[model samples]
Each structure stands twice: as C-alpha cells, then as structure tokens.
Target chain A: MNLMMLLEMASQGFADRGAVQNGDQRLSYAELFSAAGGAAGIAREAGVEKLAVLDVSSLAVPVGLFGAAWSGKPFVPLNYRLTDAELESLASQIAPSLLVTSRDRVGSLSKLPDTQVMERDEFLERALGAETPTADWSMDPDEIAILLFTSGTTGAPKAAVLRHKHLVAYILGSVEFAGAAEEDAALVSVPPYHVAGMSAICSSVYAGRRIVQLPSFDPDEWLRLAREEGVSNAFVVPTMLSRIVDSIGEGAEAGLPGLRAVSYGGGKMPLPVIARAMRAFPDTNFTNAYGLTETSSTITVLGPEDHRVAAASDDEAVRRRLTSVGQALPTVEIEIRDENGAKLGPGERGEIYVRGEQVSGEYLGRGSSVLNDGFFPTRDAGSMDAEGYLFIEGRADDVIVRGGENMSPGEIEDVLLEHPAVADAGVVGVPDEEWGEAVAAAVVLKDGQDASSQDLQVWVRERLRSSRTPQRIEFRGELPYNETGKLLRRVLRTELAS
Target chain B: MGQLKAGSRLRSAVCDTEVMVVAAPAAEVELSCGGAAMLEIAAARSGDGAPAPDAAEGTQLGKRYVNEAGDLEILCTKPGQGSLGVAGALLTVKEAKPLPASD
Candidate 1:
C-alpha cells in the first residue's frame, strides 16, 4: 500500500488529534492530510520525478513525506550536514526534482541543472494555501517510496531503495493501529534522512501519536520539551542517549516521569551509558533496536521487559543479554552464517543473514544484493545465544584478523571499556609484517582518571587471552563518532597506522 | 479459488469492502467475502448478493482478518458490511499486539 494510505487512515481514525508539532506550529491529522495533498499538487504540477528534502526536522518533513507518496514520487531526504560540494553531488543524482531546502541554500541550489528549488518557508506557505487535489495516490506496492543514501562509513554512499510494500509490511508487523493514547506525544529528535526517522513518521501515524519535532538535538532542549509536552515516547541514537544521561547526572528522581518508553539504536550502546540511563529513568522502558537501512527499520528489538529481566537475572548468560540487540521480530527470520554460506548454530559467530517481507535488499544503481535463496547478507558480524538473543559484534570489516585468526574488535573493546579509567575505546587491526596484522587500540580516558598503556594491556590480558590484547595502544581525549554514534573505525585505522 | 499472494488487492462484488492480502496460505483456498466470491480489483462489483446468515458480521477499516491456521491475512482498507471467509469458514479479526515504539 501507499504511505499516503497510512495518513488517510489516520485522518479518518482521529481527525481532530494533533498529528505533528514543531516549535509554535501544529497540525491536526486532518490538516496534515490536506497539507500532504497540497504538497502533492505542487509536486504534480512541477512535473518532477522525485521529491527531496534538505532541511532539519519540522512540520514540512511529514508534509513532504506523505506528499511525495501522494504524488507517487520517491521521497529523498538528503543529509543537510553535508558540505556544498557533497550536497550538490547528491542533489544532482535526483535531477529534475523538487528540492525543498532551508532558505539560505535556495539561491545557490536553484542553479543546479534540471532541479527545482523551493525554500522551506515558501514551500510551506504555498502548500498550506494550495487546494488539495481530488485524485488518490497509486496503490502499486512495487512503487518506490523512499531513497535513503547510506552513511558510507566504508566508502561512497549508495542509494537504498525501499518500496511501498516493504515499509508497509514493517509497519503492519510491528505497530498496532491507534494504539497510542491521546495524550501521548513522541519527541522525534532524529533527522529525516535516517531510516529510523522515516519509519518514526509512518509508525507514529499508524499508531495515532502526536509527534513533536526537534529540528536538531540539544540535551537541555530535549529534556525541556519532554517535560513541557508530556512526551511519553522517544527514539534517540546511542550517543544522544549518553549525552542525555550525562546531562541528568547521578540522580534518584525519575527524569521525565511522563516518559513511558525510550528506544536507542543506530550505534553500539556502551554498557556504562545504558546502565546509567536505566538508573536515571527507572520507570522508563528501555528498548534496544537494531537494524540497517536495507531493512525497512527495526528487524529485531530488545524489548523493555528483556532489559529488566536481564538486569535482575542471576544467570550470567541472562545478564549478558543486556548488551545484546535482542531477538528477531515475529515476521523476521535471522541466521548466522559462515563465509562459505553455511548456517552456524547458536554461540557460533558469523555474518548475519536475514529474510523477511521488510528486507529491501535492492539498491538504486546497484542491483539487488539479496541472494538466490532470498536471504540478504547483512555484513554485520554477530552471534545468537541458545535462547535466540542476537549479539552484534561490529561490522564484518571491523573484525580484526591477525595472522589469519579471526577476532572481534568488540570483544577486546569490551575488556578495555571495563577498565574503570577507560571512557571509550576502539580496537582495529594495524598492518604488521610479522603477523600480517596486529591488534591496536585507541582509548579515551575518563576525566580525573588515569591508566597507562601497559596497565590497560594487562587488564585486557587478564580478562582475555594475551593474543587478544592490544599490541599497541594510544590514549585520546575522545573517540571519533558520527552524528549517529557509529564509531569511525576507518578513521581510527588510519590514525593508528602511524 | 486459487493462490493469493501478499500485496494483491481484492474487492467484494456484493459490498464496498476492499482488502489487501497481507499473507496467504501455500495451499489453494477459496477466499470469499459476504458469502460471495472475492474478485480482483479490476472486476466490477455486481452488488447482487445480500449478507449471508452466520457470516453477516461487518468488516472494519484497518482490521486484519485471518483464517484459523493463521496463514492467510487480509487487511480491510475500506469498511463494509461484508464478513471475510476462507474455504467456507468465517475469518476472525486478528488481535493487534502493540509493540514498544521503536524508530
């Protein structure tokens, strides 16, 4: 089904409820529906093939999202954080398109070939004024709904194509229609470019939630909005959560007592950070969601109940699950396979392969990456426990191979992070003539705490084997992480090469 | 009266009910609504049959009706006075289990 169908249902399900709020601006479900239609009319009139958004989060985001769907055009949200050259390169890919962007870029972007540039403010005003068209959106399930450019942590970005069916399946399998309470408001701090950001719109609409937009994330502002709006739900990347936890500091009070649930993903959640967050928000249910852009949104989720159980359990295996990404969703099937494509049993580490309706293994320029058997190799190294809990062990290339021995950087990084002085750590394989590669680590020490290279090495050697210990170590003020909290291991590899 | 794949749209000839197949069984099954055969989207609705006894229950918009084996899932996109049935048996509305909101 079309994404517009979700909006259509929401408008009918709860017409008077607030669908979106940004700053002083607000739109009811009915208004958002009509606004989307207005945007669609503009898109249709422009004769554009795609709709692109190059601005921070706002009412314009949802309006543009459903508008693109209503007009049967792919919605492409470019990373606004990119530089002029970078933005121009991406914008050129979807030429002959309507680019809704911030006011400052309109003049420069209008020069791009075959591109129609509309300032975000002007677009909003026009869309608000335009009469909604009468025609309904196309129902072709194979129609492209979203085109997300991958973060390209490894290399150049590739456009990941998500069809209407994949996204609809994800929403249908995961969300319950009109499940959210009338007073429940979701604080959306994530950017519109990310897959999670897009799914947040669809799922919230289907669930009839009042979405409160945060254009850009600020810890104090986030907390203030949560309190002011009585936000019951929120989704933040790991780094955002860490900062929010740090901002709250050590406290007994339930921060934002109205927050009923908090889900964090998009990067590894450090043990210390999540532990502190759980304590800070004692009543909030913590969900650890893990998925890739290729997978509509979340393929597996560590539910809130799992967090409480794992934390309070006496069993070591059960307690370790607090760090795991949890089990696969009912509609998803996950398997860990070796390099030869052989499926591995529980406790055997291998690459993650998944198959389900939500798995969109197709890319824009590149053909489908899905295997003949329908499983998409995730390129993520991980393992599953007997109980089906999945543990993500960094990306496949992130695995350190020293002298042909496969080692997980996450395993070594865990031991180093356990050191009381270590605040952050990244382990990589540095080139070594004798062993082909050797273990090297970059660590950030907590303020007011000190630990020598040898001290931390011994700590890892004691916990793990000597071979797993870092051969070289360097201390830094902090590790490099993207806005989304993924550690730039490629950057670490280059820095440690010297 | 044949294989129904997910994403296929169907409509009832006797009512305004339109549904998209969310899931379908591997074996052949006759999928019907309001005791009349469900036709493809392109087929014109005849509106000839009334709601049959023992299957007069109406279909709600956005509700998913599934067979007993839990394989065939039909999501009603339009509310109508037709009850969805499969293989001469009535389909029940599947309970929606709300998952924790995760982006």
Candidate 2:
C-alpha cells in the first residue's frame, strides 16, 4: 500500500545487498532503510508537507523519494534542466516545501516564500546523519506519493499526481519481489524527474536489484559504468540507444559483458538501430516498453522473445511485431476507441484507452481523466493486430515532443509571429533519426518584408529555449488551413518532408 | 478483516507469510492460511499453531496463489510454512509468467 513497504521488505529480504551506488558512495538495503527513516525524521521536523528535489540524479534521489513516503509527504522531483524563472514558477506551485538542490541554485530559489532550500550535499549529509525514526509509515493507499510536473499541450505544466496504490499496483503486477539475485545491478541513467527514473527506483528496490546512478548520460560513460558495475539491467530512451550503438563496433569485444536486458521507450526505435545494436551485443535482450506518465510507467511491453522472433521470421506479419509494443500486462485491459467513445475492433487505429489499478489519470487541480467506463484515454493513436500486439502511430494531438520533452507549437509560433517581418507561422513535428522528431515551421512573410531563416531562428531562441527553437524553417506564400480555420498540420508535414 | 480489495495486505497468524490481494471475488469468502483465518497485516501474529496436514504445502516467496474459479489471486511477499486456502480449498501457485520486467 505504500512505497516504504517495498523498501522495508527489501531490507528484510537482503540486508547486506547494495541498494544504491554513486561514485564509491553506496548504501546497502539495511542502510537505505535506515537512511529513509532518517529522511522522514528530517522532513517531519522541518514541518514541510512535501519534499522536492531540484538537483540531478544522486544518492539524494532515492533518499528523498523513500524518505518522503515515510514522512507521509508527497515527493516532488522537479526538472533541473529548466531555466531559473521556470524553476521558480514550479517551486511556487509546491510551496511550503523542502527543496533539495545544488549549491549554486540555493540563493535564488530560497527567495520564494515558504520554500526552504537545502544544498544537495548538506541535505544528503543531514539525511544520512539524522536520527532514524521507527518504521511507522502510513499504509493508506490513497495518500499522494509523487508529484511529477508534465507539460501538456497547454499554457502551464500540470502536476501528475501518483498515489501510493497506483504505484504499488504497477510494481506488484509487473515485478516479482526479491526475484533478482544478489549480484544483479540495474543501471539508472535517466533523469530523476522522468517517470522512468521514479519507477526504476521502486522496481529495483522491490526486486532487490542494486541501483547505479548516472546523472548525465554519455554513451562511453554509460558503457564504462555498466562494465565496471556488472550491470545486468538497463533502461534507455531510443535516442540514447541509437547513440550508444553509434559509439561501439559490431563485435563481441565491444559488447557489455554482463548486460542481460536492455529496454527502451519514450520514442520510436528504428529497426536499423536496434538491428545494429543486437549484432553488437549478441547476449543482450531488447524490450520495447510503451506507457504514458498517467499510466504509471510501462503498461505494455514487447518482451525479449518477441524481438528475436520478429527479427528472424520471414513472414511480414510476424516480423512487424518488432515495432509493436506487444500486449498489455496480465492485470491491465487495453482498448482502442473512436472519438464517439465507442470501442473499435482489432486492426483499427484509434485513441489508446487503458484501464487498470495502476493507471492514475488524475492531475493536481483538474478532475480525473478516466471516463465513466473506467478507461483512461491515452490521447495516443495506435492499433493492435489480431494477436494483441500494439503499434504506436503518433500523438493524437499536435503536441511536438522532441527528445522526450513536450514542446508547445503554439508557443513557438507565437514567438515567430512577434517578428515584424513575419505574417503567419505554422509549427509541426518532422521525423528525425535522433530525438524522434524535430521542430519544423513553415512561414509566410509580410508584404515587402525580407528576413532570412537565421534571423527568425535567433529571434525565437532568445524568446524560448534552444530546444524549442525550430530546426527547419521554410518560407512559402501561405500555410495550409482547412475550411474551419484549423491549421492543417498533416498537410504541412507532408509538404515539408517532400 | 478489511474488504478484500486489490491492494489489501494480509498476514498469516500462524506464520510469517504475508500476501496482497490481487484479484478478489465478487462475494466475500473465507480466506485462510495454515488452517487459520488470515488476519489483517496490522494484527499481531500468535505463531503458535502448526500447519494442518491437508494445508502443509509451504508457500513460496514472490509467487501468485489462485483459486480454481480464477476470481481470487494473492501474491506472497514473505515465505513461511503456511499454505494459502480459500473456502477450505488449497490455492495453487501460478507457474511460468509469460513476460519479463519491462523497467
């Protein structure tokens, strides 16, 4: 019913096993248990209702995570890559909070009201040194456990609220307790703010797998850590996998010796990239996990055998399973439904709707997104074959998610419109090998006005972050629009691609 | 005893075995361990009685026990010398999970 229960059980099952490690700093299961108790005590005495970590992945990530659960306060992991102003805006939303962050960010972040900023090193030191409280964490399933800020296709970000029961169900349904051997280590290279990072901690803890943290992901460094740590499990995004394949050669000597499993999601994995990777590391098992932030972590997974069978089969139907996300979990039910809220049969592409105990389709202020029929509309377009294999097409909406981060097209276009020489603009996601998709825009110039693509790119880069800046900008007479005045993004995408 | 919801946690009164309800039947049924009624996890365990001959099959850690009707499923978090039972029938462990951990 609680995240602490997973840690408690792991501590009892294997007290001496390593729970977390970061550069010669390690905590055994018993040590992590005690440190979580200490973290709870610190938060309780500080009188904060929530514990938010603004720093990168480190030992404090797990401590703050389990510690907040023990303290009965929601743990909030903020994205550290945001600008200072954006970071403060989100900090204000979760005010009256204990903010764990780096040293340089403390002064400006502490200026906010009711926000107590503790440096990362100091926070870890105090959390590790405080008096350990007894294991008396609340078992109420409805208690809020984590608050992850996800930017929808809207103005501001919404806090995706994950309750204890939602996460517990996901873990218990998918992961077996203490199923990992003592020597099994999981390489956690994703950012702590990501959904994958949060779920990795819970799954690894319950499985009694050692966690090796990597704050910044580099292909060489990742492989080095994996080789040195004897890592058996790993999860990466498609962009990371492609780059990792690009770094190493295709031979046994280049393979990660002990890596048994490698799972990827967050973007489509090209067949050539994975094919090259499988040849590079012949012993590794590749899985493609597909899920949304609202549905906990992974609701459907293409297992290892499916990858092999799909790659080896000459039949097109069986080989197409390589791109499918496979079937739903044993405890989950998935359906494809049209816009009329009616269910569609197999081989029909519609919005992906899922129903399960693990799906927490609720935001902080907004009401539950789950429909009356108990199905949560995933807002993703996908179809399933007759055998229940799910294939993802793309986002149902026009939200441009580049490199796993959501970028608002309207916001970018609005900035381009601010240019005095620009009359109108339309932004859409174009296919790219890395980052899954790149931001591209088509623009129409004002009468008797002259401006180059470089001029507009700099204008937007100053207004927005570089990541949101359009990679490709094309000048045309006008952008395509329908009779109802809705921008025809699909037509623009095809026009730009050709 | 609390309602047998999916996330409900229960413990065997005669042994250290603990389980969480995964799939519950529509109707409340007698769920027992070691021939004795399983108590809520918060309840104190006596650890005095031995497993009956018919229910002596020990439970395994990280295994799912299900009844014949497939309406009730429980996951064992801790192992002990107690067999899971529902309505006087011994539960069987589900063997060979079809999928591996995705994360």
Candidate 3:
C-alpha cells in the first residue's frame, strides 16, 4: 500500500527509462529509485517526523515524495509562493521537519526552531552519497502518505490527509502500470504544492512516462519546452491554457506536433478559450478534468472524444456539454443531492456528492466528514443530465439567491462568454435592498473588441430569461484568478457588494 | 478460511505467486492458487511446493485475475510460475479498460 511500491514497480519494470527531467538534467528510473532510497536514509538519520518541500518544481520533489514514503512519513509540500510569515507559520506547524528549499532561502528557513533546512543541491548530493536504506516501508493502508494544505479562498488553510490506500487506489484504478510508451513525456508546469503536481509525478512514474518539469509557467516557455523535449502529454490549469492559446494567437502555427494529449483542470475553463485551444492544437487530444484536493485528483474527466463531439455538434445540448465536466470515472459514483441529503434527479440543481475509495474527506484536526453511507459532500453546486454529464456550477456558497430562487452564476457567465466580444467573465451575487441578492458580472473583452454593458445584458436576456440577465455589468481589463486558475468570486462579490 | 477483504495480501504456499485483494465477496470462500490453499502474507509458510499440472499456467506481474462470478478479484503483486484460482476454478486475466491519462 506504500507509495514507494509504485516507484519500486516502475524501477523494476523499466529501470532504464527516463523517470524525471528538469531543464537539461534527467534521472532514469533506476537512478530515481536509488536516490529515493538514499533520501530515506537521510530522513531516518535526521529523525524527522515529516519531510517538507518549500521550493518550486525540481528533482527534489520526486526524491522528497518517494523518500518520505520510503521513510514512512507524510510528505508536506508547502506553497513556495506564500509570504514569508505565512510560510513560516505552516513550517512551524510541522516542526522537527526536514525542510528542502532553494539555496538562497536556506539561511532564513534554517532559523526556525526544530527545523533543518538544506539547500536542494546539498540535499541531493548528500542523498546520492549516503547508503540506500533497506526496503522497510509499512504496508498499513491507514498510514498517511501526504498532507496537502487546501488552498482556502475564504478561511485559514487546513491540511487534507491522503492515506496510502486512497492514493494507491486512485492510481491503480485510473492509470495502468507501464501503460505509457517509453517515448512518452509529460510536461508538468504546476507547482509542487498542488495535488495535480503530486499526482502527476506518481501517475507518470507508474505509467512509465518521463516527466519534464517547468519551474514556472510561461506560455511561450511551455511551448518551447514541449517542442524541445518532444513532450507528448501535459497537464495545465485553465489559466495556463488560456495564456498558451493567446500566445499561439490567430493563424499562428502551433509548432508542437509531438504533443498528443493535453488535460486542463484546477478551475472552470472559459468556453471560448477552450474552443480556441482546440483549434490551436488541432492534432492534440484535449481533456477537461474535474476534481478537488480531497478526491486525490481527477474523479471525472471530459475526455478527448467528448471534446471533439461537443465542439462539432450543432445541437445546443450537445455543444453545451463542452462546459460540463463529463461522467464519473468507473471507480467513482457521483450523485446530486438536495439540502436535505436526498438524491436529486437529473437536471436538478443540488450539491454534488461523490463516493469512491480515493475520496478522503478527513481534515487534519477535523474528523471524517464522509457520511455513514460513504458519500462525501463536495459543497459544489452542480447537476447531472439524463446522459450522466455533470455540470458544475460555482461553489454552493456562491449561489446567488435572488428573491428566494437559487441562481447559478456559472449559467449567467456561460451566456456572457458566448458573446463574441467577451473573452473572460466572472459572475457574482451582490447584496441588494430590494431582493436578497442581485446578479452582477465583471467581464474582460477580447482584444480590439468593443461591447457596451447594455449589449451584453441583451445578449444574456436573448438566450436566457430576463431575470437571469446581469443587473450590474462592469467592464474590466481582466477577472481575478488565483495562482491555480480558480476565479476569485469572493473577491468580486466583496468588491461589488461594497 | 477467513473472509477476504480489500487490502488483504495473500501468498500461495505452493508457488511463488502473491496477490493483493482488489475486490472480494463478503462471505468467506475457499481461495486457492495453483490448486493449493492461499495463506495470508503474515501467516504464509516458506515453501516451494510444486503447482498442480492442470493449473500450472503462470501469473504475470501487474495483471488482475478475477473469478467468473465477477466478485473475487486480485492484483498480481509478483509474478509466479503458478496461476491463480478459487475452488479449483482457474481465474482469468482481467482486461484493463485504459482511460485517457488525466492527472
């Protein structure tokens, strides 16, 4: 049940295959396994309870991840983008930890009490020089494998615990062992702290796909690396994909012929942007993956075929599925439930609930939130169509209750995006004296395009009911998006309310 | 025989085959590999007993074996010279329906 088992199997199955690469540096499966073993030795010698990485994506991520597993400790990857005080607070919580960071930050991080900060290079060198530890990872499924601090847009962050069994089941259920070709390379640009980043490492390793890391995301740089490294697959947040598409621009050649598949998730993707991307990379398979950190990774995927079918279909319902997150994975069961916990029928708006072996609804201090029947309330307002396509609206808290009718901002936003002039849009519920709330929108126009707020209102009114039209439309340069591509609806709501 | 549950690791005493339960029936059943009774990893006896001639087909690493009833399923953690079976009925390799790689 240990995560090391996946890496060990990969090393045994394809020891000579490339496992990880950063810039010009690369590590084969055999070398990565050896490094993990060595790192485990260092962790055991330091007697640290946990191994934490505060640096960007690098060789340290995989080494630290598998190393922690081999050492039987929960691996914690903190957001390096956090402010100094914020990072310090989190580091202190995991005291007596082996903190791995870049060389420049080592001096400052080393000052923390009960912490040992080592530069990434020094840690790797020492690990390479140290003796490899014996294979002694526990097989207990209850053992904690990772502690991911959920990116709370509203409150203080909490660590979401992922056990060995949960993660192993996720990988085993979704990805086949050695399924990838030896030539397949997956370009990963997400930060190591995110669940997608960690899952990419494990999934690529077990699937025998070589990982090419991008320390920071830049659309041009992503394209350059994809071409230079023969990257056949990649996982990007919607923001990254938007930028990549913009970089490709109109009528420009997307020189990445080797790119076969690209999966976008971590946020709600704007329809126009995805449509543009499909044209930009005509040969590449596009997937819209939807999940949360609590679900290990992606529980449902709008796969490649659906993307093409939806884009080409003339039917409104069929084309509308382009915005849906598609059906649940074979291992997962998804249900839309009312506030009373009753399962809702198709096309009924309610809370999204999921049940699966990979779903870990337990927080660090908070006990398990999973219901007695094993369903985990996702807190996301969404609905399912008759064919089982799941349409995710904004978070339940973001639902705009205007005169007691629950209205989904995503519905309004989608209509606005269909406008030819709109490039980006964010819809929120603003407090109103007359009604309980009113629908407000902030939109970014496409470059060189012009559209009045009246025109946009009519655009929605024509497609949807008059009540669904935006009461307040503010033209903006851009919508606020978090680093991971989630729209800051709370920020917009606050600004509009004031 | 003990009731098989998920996460249970079993090894064939008669051969080198080892498996981890992926899915199992709720009720206790006679599970055997290579025509010999399977023992839990913790209680497995160290032996290299020969496999029955009728069930000598070897197991493959990373492959899943399932019973005809679609209830009992085990993932081969280690390949061995003996095949997996239950109640003298040979298990078949479960074909994997490959999903698109989505991280």
Q: Indicate which candidate wins on DockQ.
A: 3
lDDT of 1: 0.90
Let me know the TM-score candidate 2 reaches against the reference structure: 0.82
Q: Clashing residue pairs in candidate 1, if any?
A: none
Measured against the true two-chain complex, the DockQ scores of the candidates, in the order shown, are: 0.65, 0.58, 0.67
Which 10-residue window in model 3 chain A sums to the lowest lDDT? Answer: A126-135
Tens digit of per-residue lDDT, candidate 3, span A135-198: 7888888999999998887688888999999999999899998899989999999999999999
In the predicted model 2, the residue pairs found to clash are none
The digit string of per-residue lDDT tens for model 2 on A134-202 reads 778988899999999873333477889899999998988888788898899999988888888999999
Off by over 4 Å in 1: A252-254, B1-3, B14-16, B26-30, B39-50
User: Which candidate order results from sorting by TM-score in descending order?
Assistant: 3, 1, 2
Q: What residue pairs are clashing in model 3?
A: none
Candidate 3 Cα misplacement greater than 4 A, ranges: B42-48
lDDT for each candidate structure:
0.90, 0.85, 0.90
